[model samples]
Target: MPFWRHPSPSLQPLSLLLLLGTLPLLCSAATPGQLPAKRIQPLPASNLGSGRVETKGPGLYELTAERRAALETIRYAEGTWKGGSSIGYRILYGGGTFNSFERHPDTVVVKRYASAAAGAYQFLPGTWEAATRSLGLSGFGPASQDQAALHLIERRGALAELDRGVLTDQAINRLAQEWASFPTASGGSAYGQPSKSVEQLRAFHRESLRRHQLRREGAPA
Candidate 1:
């Protein structure tokens, strides 16, 4: 048998270059039924537009594109109309925070209104209590208020239609009962002092739908 010896040290660099050159081809080769290993990449940052990123955990974020769309939609339809987080109707009506228990003086249906309409959405006391208790919501933060409003929309069975941009007048009328700003079938206030006309509500909703579609389709805001 011939004696085996190590290669010369001068050849080591050339040997390393050849091995490195073949390494890629070796790694790229796979069984007939298998695929080559894919390069793992960290996730790209979310494009949630102008909304601020809300941290949910140590590394988790909540400001996604879909979330921004929903928040914007609600802001236009509810927050903008009711009084935004700042200087919204809830505050003037003596209702802006969860702890707000002040009664609105406006009367509806010949009865003196007593429930507090608090939060950006202007949730009535009974409505907020029922919703929060049923949904197990801990507080009335922006996220919680968003969830509660969306939950009400889901209950009305209009969420799917709204998302699809096919909500009808009838659906809108029905949903309007859930909000005082919108007119009812009889064109009367469900709650006292609904300042917005039906035409205004319709226009707002139409614009909202258009904006929603724009965002969903990746068009400019």
Candidate 2:
């Protein structure tokens, strides 16, 4: 979909992971340093075919043309965070839309941004806005209205075992075509294979698990 298409109406410009004041989804106690296994369904950024994705998080690098064209297998990208444990919000661009990825353990959530979410997440940086208008490039509303959809089965619950294979043949085909046609550098709510995103997801999950253990042992946050 286009950037103007919003992902969610209720969510505001939440560029950081939100502690929505709800009880976290319950999960089994896992061994130290081990991620509690959960099903992961990926939304493709650029028509990349399905591949193994062991983690979840936003990607940082822009999807390049070569990366977009050569992504026959899922390519994951990496992300950076300021806080110690990476449970925060960030506005990462994907193929065509900007979506949200929540890592609340058993409550891992993916919400495709609606118009509101787009407005909430758009980068109306002071510099960019002035530059565009000076060059007669209209306004930022058009750029902020765009959004992406989530491929997750459960809107609130963690991914399931069977859901791991959620990436279908048709989805991959559609992604490939979308990448080829998509004009922007990034926007998405789905997972990429083997790209920098994949690594970030893995690291996020590992740290989340570590944090869980720390909480259990009463470590300082």
Candidate 3:
């Protein structure tokens, strides 16, 4: 069963704004005193398969090479990653874990901090609800999560730049407001928590892009 029903169109914008505004205080990738988790290994190529993702609005968004790499880069910074393993989709906030994908884990992890964030993109319950409604997405599977994350990037107005393989400072800054793990232009977390440096994210993005390009060219990644 879907955990969220579609919100009325009339109320969507205001509701989404309120939910997103709380992200900075509620969505830190790691709690205080802990560094973001490092990637254990690369995800299998099978995990990178492309799919057609539909939006509530007109036009379709395919998971293209550059978009996939950009999504992976965001995953890398978000600490929910374990080499892009499926386990990342089961992670709860504050190092806890869950086993279901029927819905957002909605488990408020309390340790150094408390948050209901879960999955590869660390979506809070409200944020996830908003995303599902906005993108007409269902389930909490890896594919759905990826679509939702991309929807977020699109909403932040950074998806075009990312698709162009240009992760400009402006794009990163726009995204930083939504994902605390991404650093702002001034190289700091919007929430004042630890964040990945722009250089680090750029390096990861470059490597990911290279791998995707190689795969596209039918060569070894």
Candidate 4:
């Protein structure tokens, strides 16, 4: 079954609740003879927490340090960061790479579940189209994916809370509806699929914040 259906009330359609026992291995595996895509390197330690906000298309939003860390936490939960690389940007629904970022690689991969979800955020085609149109994003590259995910967070009304460095249970609960990987208040996958624990998410976010602070202070990450 498809991961999402169109004309849903939410910014993203509900995801397919498929058995994901092998999802981790699928996420890290590349297709035969397909070279891994170049990774989008992390910002230098000196650049973290420099108070420099990256403006998304037409300055629609600023990616502050807290917000960036929150996004990274989402990526972590989504199983998109393969071996510390941004190969997730080129990842298809189940696993495997797409050649171009000129647009969402709307290829539905059929494993235990079928989905056109792609990119680091696993945006379905409909979601990606909506985000790109809303944000004037022209590509499916790393910056565009980040901005798109932020837009979804904003749609869920959690952006302000995230910016305040308050990744509270309430905020996470609100975001859970958008990303299946995020646990709900009860610490289960909102979609009845695999998910990370709320405790794990909180811990990851805290460590990410600490690492950013360390970078800002010229300490080792």
Tens-place lDDT per residue, model 1, 62-177, is: 44344334334444544444423443433322332333323322221111222234555656545555555545444455555555565565555556565555445665565565
Q: Cα deviation of 168 in candidate 2 (Å)? A: 17
The Cα local distance difference test for each model comes to: 0.43, 0.25, 0.70, 0.66
Q: Give the TM-score of candidate 4.
A: 0.73
Report the lDDT of model 3 for residue 183.
89
lDDT of 2 by residue, 31-99 (tens): 111223233333233322222212244421122221221221221212212232222123332222333
Per-residue C-alpha lDDT of model 3 across residues 98-214, encoded as one tens digit per residue: 887778877765554446789988987877876676555657888878877887777777999998987789988988877888888887887767789999989988999899989
C-alpha-based local distance difference test score of model 2: 0.25
TM-score to true structure, per model? 0.52, 0.23, 0.76, 0.73
Give stretches of model 3 more than 4 Å off.
Answer: 1-25, 29-57
Global lDDT of model 1: 0.43
Residue-pair clashes per candidate? 2, 42, 0, 0
Q: Could you say which candidate leads in TM-score?
A: 3
Task: After superposing candidate 4 on the true structure, give the runs of residues whose Cα lies further than 4 Å from its correct spot.
Answer: 1-59
Candidate 4 lDDT score at position 180? 75
**Model 1: how far is 180 from its true place, Å?**
1.7
Q: After superposition, how far is residue 215 of candidate 3 from its true place, in Å?
A: 0.9
